[model samples]
Target chain A: MKGKLNLNFLFALALLATAAVLPLFLQRTSGGKYNMIVLTYAMIWAVAASSLNLVLGYTGQACLAHGAFVGIGAYSIAIMVERVGINYWLALPLTCLLTAFVGFLIGLPSFRTRGPYFAIVTLCFNVIVYATFENWTWLSGGYAGQPITLPAALSGRLARYYFVLAFLVITLLVVRQIVKSIVGASFLSILSNEGLSEAVGISAFRYKLLSFTVSCFFAGLAGALFATASGRVDSSITSYLHSFYVLIYVLIGGVATLAGPVLGAVGLYFLLDRIKGLGEFRYVGFGVLLILIIVFFPRGLVGGLNQLRDWARERRSARSPGEEVAG
Target chain B: MSFFVNQVIIGIQLGSQYMMMALGLTLIFGILDISHFAHGHIYMVGAYLLYIFSVLLGINYWLALPLCMAALALAGVLVERLVYRPLRGTPSINTFIAAIGLLLAIETLVRGIKKDAVRVPVPVDRSVSVLGMSLEVQRIIVILGALVILLLLQWFIQRTRLGIAIEAMAQDREGASLVGINVNRISALTFAIASALAGVAAVLMAPLGSITPEMGNLLILKAFVIVVIGGLGSIKGAIAGGYILGIIEALGVAYISSTYKDVFAFALLIIILAVKPTGLFGERTAS
Candidate 1:
């Protein structure tokens, strides 16, 4: 068993190492620069989606304000660097802390309701955030979009790629640690049976609040990285449609699994990018695909693959009587 | 004071449209227990269909209106049969996600067909002075037209057998089924009625301004706010909530700021959800 665990760990490490070095490899190939940019975007979105997973997947809460948190992070960096004269690096940590605090406050009222009601409140929060970004001309620069000035040292695409990659690693590690810890078990318990968990003396509100705050902190980090790489922030990032896009990533990739969000973000980003020429009809296919996925593969791609493997193994065992009895 | 009255009048006009949309939403929520996220897209379809029938096909507006409603009713039934009915026994969230997918699909279809805004020309472009305030004749027609439809809808619900059956199903699905209500048929009927209501809203609002694919997002959000305020699944609540939201929005835009008009509904929703999850007219246990 220990050997098997070691093998799994080794494989995961190998995958991570490949992912870490992928952008450098891409830069050498034809049209690699654009691919690198898209890859960086995927990684950044992966971080956000994973943070969203903390609420939607683990806690079984439908938090539609995730993009708003991302927006908050991006706008903070934009305002601080461009208007407040704070150093980009110095402003990031403060911005994340502020976002987490705001998330905690928002979660207080947002999580008070249950199910669809909660979904709407969070969605409303998303709208409010976007409205603030759009209407507050003095603060967010309104519809013109605010630009972030990355320091000369990290302005290069490759450098920014590595920069975002570092943050992605930290986010994934933190998420993995949380999911593997006692809090994660509580989260799953809450998700599996909320009323029973409460009966068993689990303070549902506290754990959920903790999850929301932590999720927002990381999402804010991802937002800062987004601003650093893109060098601009706009109200569109905070729009509820963006929130829906992030939710779709988590849903399509697989919910409740750590790798699902990453797979979904990267997969869908590239898929959409590849079909840019389709323009208006592009999302129509995705919409149908989303409905099909929800209906047939509620567990998402990873879950579907796991099921296929199990089916294959079962079939093999059935084909051999001796193996079947042993199994 | 006259400005306030004007805002109130404008609010009533906007509220009438909102009421139409929310009526369908509340009815769906009452019976199916699903929010039908794609309902807004159905409204968008109604607008586009109006544009096609009245503008492209050169059909009369009076003729186009009924045809649009009937088409939307058929579309609603198809959506219920094809998309929603299969996932009926699953978790409600699955249906919600499916609805979102449907919204995306329909919105993309419309956007792909016409990226630019499509305007529906009203027969009456003239304005009339009422109590020293100028109001568009088309606006008054839309308001009176929506009100008449709403009253007819109320009468139908109160006086007609099919409407009573729908209300019975909404109140208790299993019990109504035990009484031989034909649950499947009623489900389709409820969806049809709701979609037709949304169609009415779309047609009325289409002539008021430029119609765009993206309008569904704002319209749906407002309808949601109204549904929440009036209490989910309560027709009366939806109507009251619609007027409240419309007036507040009109006043907010007129007095406070036009740019932040959308913020009022969402902010109110948050407040309502936090303070009273059941809404003013909602039952404690239903949602």
Candidate 2:
């Protein structure tokens, strides 16, 4: 019972699997297909948000330039595949490499600042990357937006959905592994006390740079998937606002939990989208919710639920005489 | 020479505006250690409140300025007590995320109220020729108003007992608290002063251009750039950085491409931060 995460972990896994094949269950109506496509977008965002969680939640470093990295990935794919006529398959790996390299350059200097200083510096970087994307028409296709699509074999709607879902699975699994690994422990140690970690020879700088590059690699992957899945990459994708939304997902879903970003990305995405009359209230609501969540439950939805479960168990054990003590 | 002088006037005007924005950010960061990312949006809200009081309620523009400032002071205190106070002792990133959340909420709320941009009627609707360049009365007012407020702020921070306590708080929160300086009062006061300064900037600049909810977005980033360039919490640094940024932007636009007008400050930020992480005027502090 103490290792009770298994049940919820499996539950989150079920929900994600449902997102992948839900179209197969639903009639092949346009509405069904539309929902599937939205989920596909959410899946990509889940990957992006999870990447952020790897750095922000686990490592306790908030790299706010996440949206810029996503933009880099999107543009990498679009520029290579759309303009240079490179194969999509080839551009996929190239996009990841390019984004990781960029992340390394950024993280080297960025890790120099810590905590909120780091957050603001990264945010400034986001502003610069976005400005470049908006102003560099020759490369970014300008604000009019550049078109991109998957290979013909993967161009089918269901194929694109499955492709994004597959990547989300891969990101979550790898992130889980990293979180449970010795390197993951180092990230947490730094998060708790950087000076202490450094004093103990954990090399806080190297670990942070590693987490940042890894997260950025996934951000790029997600961006490339978004470009192909949505069939376009625009300055809109590069907007600093996108950074806030990605952070929002991780915060609301559950920071530090592997299932948190996935739950957050998919749950909040659908809730905001399905509620048609929400209009501007959606952002206002998300903002207020984000604040309230941080104030009340810094651990997020998953963390909140885990606390509730613990409380409920304690109450049950107190009330029942026949039950052995629950952990 | 005329072009250069005209550009200098524009730079001074812009420099004052940047000072208004950056000072608040620096003040908050110094005293409270939160970046207050929503400041640009708060400035936008202050503009909207000014619009509501002056245009919507038919109040005089000058009268509405103080009214807006007072209201935002109340708002700043409330936000401090509510949004930020609860998350104290948590990680700095928590507060930063909260700031982003608050920023989004405020921007969208204002957008919901009014999506289209509207011009605030210029209280001083005239121009003057200076150094062979036509300077509008409104532009001069913006510069003078900002400079006056900044000077007053400088005096208050340096001279007053409360201001000295505020400075002490900025320098050392724990030390200030231990010495019987009410950390809560100073924190709330710092936020109030910061928020009101932003309001003052917004009110002054509202007449110079059309106002929109999105106006604060770019301004906030530039303000952060200024704050970063000046050293995060240095008042003098913020002031210097503000003017330097404004002049660079004005001249860069005059001589270089306007398309990259926004990029100049950002480039300056990266370069300055790379060279001197302590900022040009920031003292060395532990990470």
Candidate 3:
């Protein structure tokens, strides 16, 4: 089992490396600016969705304040670059740390609560954050959102694409490692049965806080990247609807697996952009798609695919006579 | 003293509206164990229904109120039967997504019909003076109407058979079924009652605020706060929480920055959640 898992891991890594290089090769040959732009947005969303999955899927905590964290990161980064004249690279870490601190503060109190109750608390937090961003004109530039300018060095779509792509790769690997670590096991145990986890010496409070903080950090990082990518900032970007969009992306792709969010982000983005004559109906279409996916494919797209693979393997094993299969 | 009294009155009036909306949400959460995200949209639908009856159909506002309520009640029953019933036994996330979809669809449909700019007109005259503070007649009417409805609901839930069945189901679904309570019928009725109340709230609230497709977003957030602060499934809690929120907002706006009124409710929510997770009046239950 461990050997097969290692092989699968290496294969997945090789595939990702190859895919990452393919874009550069394509850019060299075709110079597809639009494709690169879309891919960058997909990477940003993938980061956001992966962060949400840490709490929602792994810890069984539904946080609706994700977009608020994104806003915090974006606004923070925007202010650092635009107002304080800080280097973009220097501002990014500060944004992540500040967002993580805010997440810890929010999670500390609410983590003690049960499921839907915690969700409501987070919902309230989102609203408050949005309201603050809108009303606090002095800090957040009010409803207009502070204007941000990307560095001239990374102004082009392709450069922004590579920046976001690299960020996504780093965050994804960090999340993947966390999910495989002992801390990840604790999160799963806490999610599965909080009381049982407590009985088994797993401090539910500690792990919940850890996962929540880590999730918010990534969301904040994504927000910073998103701000840089858009080269514009607005309070509207931090609205509850944005948080809902991220949640939809995570759930639609497959919450349990690492690759689910990336697939979800790419698929939904393309679906929204490619669907013809359905300009304003994008939300309606997305909503219906979300409902269908949740009701039928509870484990999500990746889970569904895994079930198919399992079925095929079983059939092959049943048909084969003397094929030695390692247990 | 007079200023304080005026603030109290204003708070109570606003609280009544919040109570009306939160009551339905809390009941549905309690009875069905599902968070109905579309409740606010249903309230929006109620306002639209009032506009249709009062303006388009040329009916009087008073006559149109109950008519709209009845219609929305029926719509709620249909939604419960068709949309919610089919997805029974699914995880809470499924229902949550469904509710979001339903809300989006309803809002989109309303926008499609009204071109995203429909506003319900306020049709009321006269002002009443209480303790030297003048208040609008519409505000008085809305508060009185809310109180009457709440009292009637209280009576029905306490004294009526269907209400008792709903209570039983809310307390324990499987146990209610074991005791011969028709779960489906009660759930449907709860939806009807909740929807009808939301309709009433819409009619009254539309006069004070503009009605739009996205109006429900803020209203639903407030209702959720009220329900959480009051107690997830407690009617009395909803009422108390609503009044508390309204009063806090009123005072917070008067004393603090007016722009930060919305933040007060959320700040209170965070404080309350941190200190008392079960809410002020809610009983803690293991999931």
Candidate 4:
């Protein structure tokens, strides 16, 4: 089983590497600016959604304040680079640290509350962040938000895309590592049985906080990247609505697996872009999609695929002896 | 002295509205163990229903108010039947997402119809002086309306058979069911009452301020805070939480910055969650 898992990991890594390079090669031939931009945004969302999956998907803790943490990261980087004249590269780590600290603070209180209560607390946190961002004009530039200037090395859309892609890859790898680690096992255990996990000497409180803080750190990192990518940081990006959007991405993609959020973010971004003309009706579509997906495909798109594969294996195993198997 | 008195009255008025909105949310949370995110949007819809009756149909605002409530009650039953009933034994998150989806769907539908520019008309006759301080007549009406509705709701919950069943179910769903209570019926009734209360609030609120498609977003957040701080399943907690939040908000806006007015309640929620997760009146239980 361990060897098979390692082989699967290697296969996934190769597939990702090939896909990453294929995009660059396609960019050269197709010259699809719009496509590239869409792809870039999708990748950014993928990072954010996956980070959320660390908490919501793996830990079974539903958070509605994710966009606020993203805002914190975005605003922090923008403020540092724009006003304090700090280098963007240097500011990224600082932003992540600060966001992680804030996440720890938020998580502490949320630990006591379960399910809906926890979600409401996170919702309140998001509102507070938004209110502060809009009111603390001196710090966040109020509703207008602060304009961001990209570093000299990363000026063009193509370059920015690659930069974002690189960040997404790194964040994915980090998440993958965490999920494969003992801490990840603990996280899964907590999600499965919080009481049993506690009884089994795994401190659910400590691990829950750890998962939350780590998730927030990456979410903040994505936010910082997003701020630079968009060239502006606004409270609108941190709105409760945006948080819901991210949640939608996580839910629709498949929360249990690592690649679920990636598929969801990329899929939903393009889906929305395609139906942009629907205007407000777009949300109606999105909402309906969420309900249908939850009611019927709770395992999500990726999880459903995994189930199919498992079912195929079972069928093959149950086949009569000496039956020829065709691949 | 008049200034202080005026602020107190305004605070109470705001508190009353908060209580009216929070009461339904509290009851739903207590009974269903689910957070109804669409409740605010329903309130928004109710206000728009009033807008249609009074503005378009040319009905009297007083008559339109009850009409709006009746419509919302119908909508509530539909939502409960279609949405809540399907996910009875599902995880709470499933219900939460469904509620969010419903909120998005409703808000989007309203926005599509109104082009997202619809605002509730402000009632005529802005300022009326009581003693030395002047206040908005609409504001006073809103306060009175909220208080009357809350009193009626409280009476219904305490005195009525359906209300008693709801209370019992809220206390212990399995136990209530074992005692011949129709859990599904009570759940539907709870949704109906909550939606109707929200409708009444919308009507009262419409005259006081302009209604926008997204207006309910902030109101919902504030209501959640009130419900949480009041102690999840406790009606008295909801009332106390609402008044406390309203007073704090008014005072915070007066002394601090108006832009940060919403932050006070949220900050309070976080503090309460951290220090005492069960809220002021909620009992702590291990799940």
Root-mean-square deviation per candidate: 2.2, 2.4, 2.5, 2.6
TM-score of each: 0.95, 0.95, 0.93, 0.94
User: Which of the predicted structures, 1 or 2, would earn the higher TM-score when compared with the native?
Assistant: 1
Residue B199, model 4, lDDT: 90
User: How much lDDT does each candidate structure score?
Assistant: 0.87, 0.87, 0.83, 0.84
For each candidate, report its DockQ versus the true two-chain complex. Answer: 0.67, 0.65, 0.54, 0.66
Candidate 1 chain B worst ten-residue window by lDDT: B278-287
Kindly provide the TM-score of model 3 when superposed on the true structure, using C-alpha atoms: 0.93
Off by over 4 Å in 4: A1-18, A22-31, A142-144, A320-327, B116-127, B285-287
Question: A1-327 in candidate 1: lDDT tens per residue?
Answer: 455358657976897898877877798986888999998898899899999988888988878888899999988988998998998779999889989999999998777776666777788889888888877878787777899888998978989888888888788889989989999999889888888999999999899899999999998998898888888887888888878888899999989877789889989998899889999798998899889988999888877876787798778977886975553
**A-chain TM-score of every model:** 0.93, 0.93, 0.91, 0.92
lDDT tens digits by residue: candidate 4, A1-327: 565478668977885786567566657755566778778888888889999999999989888888899889999999999999998889989999999999998899877777766787798889888877776788888768899888888788788888888898898889989999999999999999888999999999899899999999999988988987889988787777778988999999999688889889988998898889888898898898888888888888988887897788678767853432433
The digit string of per-residue lDDT tens for model 3 on B69-157 reads 99999989987886688789965656776777778777767776676556656677678888888888888888899999999999999
Q: Mark the 10 consecutive residues where model 2 chain A has the least summed lDDT.
A: A318-327
Across B21-76, the per-residue lDDT of candidate 1 in tens digits comes to 99999889888898788898999999999999999999998898899999999999
Candidate 3 local lDDT, A156-252, one digit each (tens) = 8777877888888898889889999999999999878888999999999899999999999999999999899888888887888878888888888
DockQ, Cα level, model 1: 0.67
Residue-by-residue lDDT tens digits, candidate 2, A1-327: 545677767887687777755879654787887888888898899999999999989999888888999999998998899888999899999999999999999987787777877887788789888888788888788767898866788878788888888898888889989989999999999888989999999999999999999999999999999898888888889878888899999999998988889889988887878986968877998899999999899999988987898899778888985684534
